[model samples]
Target: MGLLSVRNRFIEKLRNFATLSDPAEAALEAATRNASKLPARRDLIREGDRPGPVFVVLDGWACRYKILPNGGRQILAYLMPGDCCDLHIGLLAEMDHGIQTITPAQVATISGGEMDSLLTDHRGFARAMYITQLVDEGTMRAWITSMGRRTSKERASHLLCELYLRARNIGLTDGIELVLPLSQIMLADSLGMTPVHLNRVLKELRLSGTIQLRRGSVAIVDPARLAQIAGFDENYLHRRLRPAIAG
Candidate 1:
């Protein structure tokens, strides 16, 4: 696909959170013009690396992760098409976690100056960016809740539901089916499960006719049933843009 089209996907995501004026859209277009292609399983950024450009996913998937002392990796967040890695990461002295591509991907690296201009000069863009960060925090809270309180099966279901909705939000889904592009190892790491245990949970979900999994895709056979199992609520996603707060 053309770079313009890919960049439009990022614009589409921002539009979910705030109305972007024409100049704001043009600034984003200019800021994301420099994109690089990465192969699957490549590290985009490493822990302790000095912050550089803000990375935006143009296509394919990437993840935020950290390696534990025991050498195990914990996947923190998935970066799908149009998701920005961190709008304010430039302020950090060094990265505390790593980011890696899960599939062959296209990522745009926006320089700190461009990012600062967007945040300082464009009110709508700034609001959208801030709201995106808030939504990211909300997602982290939900993941914490799942890890600390949910059963293995519930965790699996909850994650699938979240992925499905997120993909749908960014126009990545076709009906109830979406490309997952994640390995069992990746999923297990994200869900805090052994691959063996995750396999069992997936089997049960399949047997219950809640979902159908293929090589790189999953079909939600019964989304309502799946949501019920996970106690899924879309509110945490904060899908709509609310009125801006008055200073």
Candidate 2:
């Protein structure tokens, strides 16, 4: 894709939090103009590496994860198109977790100097970026809740629901169909279940007419039903901006 298109995607995600001024938009466009493409299953950054330029996913999917000494991996979060891996990670001395691409991905790197200027000179952009971080934290909390309290079926359903909505928000969905690009192994790892157990849960969902899974894709046959089974509430995503209330 062209640079303009990439900038538009980032702006689209930021608009979910705050309105951007002309300069803010221009700054982002310039910062993200140069992008590099990486093949699927490539590691963008690894644990213990020194923090460098903040990486943004301009296209395809990436993930935040940590691997245990036992060779087990735990996926912490999914990074969709337009999602930045870490906007303010410059303060950290080293990466605590690794980031890897789930598909052939286009990524942009914003230097610490440019990031500082964007945050210092652009109030609207800074506010939007801060809120974006807040939403990321909220998403992590939701994932924790899913792992600790939800059953296997509920976890699968909830993840599907969340990915569908997120894809829809970023205009990646065609109606209720989403191009998930995720393998069963990746999904199983994200949901904290064995591949066999996740396959069973997906079978149950398909049998119940909640969703239909195709190669690297999913069609939500009954969105409301799927959400109901997952007991999902989109409030945690904070897609809509609410006015500040007076104290």
In model 2, pairs of residues that clash are none
Provide TM-scores for the models.
0.95, 0.94
| Model 1, total clashes | 0
**Off by more than 4 A, model 1:** 1-7, 242-247
Worst 10 residues of 2 by lDDT: 1-10
Q: On residues 1-247, what C-alpha lDDT tens digit does candidate 1 reach at each position?
A: 2333544678888887888888888888888777788788999899999988889989888999999999999999998888998887889999999999998888999888888878888888889888889999999999999999999998999999999999998878769898899999999999999999999999999999999999999999999999999999988889966635321
Model 1 whole-model lDDT (C-alpha atoms): 0.89
Q: lDDT winner among the candidates?
A: 1
lDDT of each: 0.89, 0.87
For candidate 1, what's the RMSD? 2.2
* Residue range 24-53, candidate 2, lDDT tens digits: 888888888788888889999999999999
Report the C-alpha displacement of residue 8, candidate 1, in angstroms. Answer: 2.0
Of candidate 1, the 10-residue stretch with the lowest lDDT total is 1-10
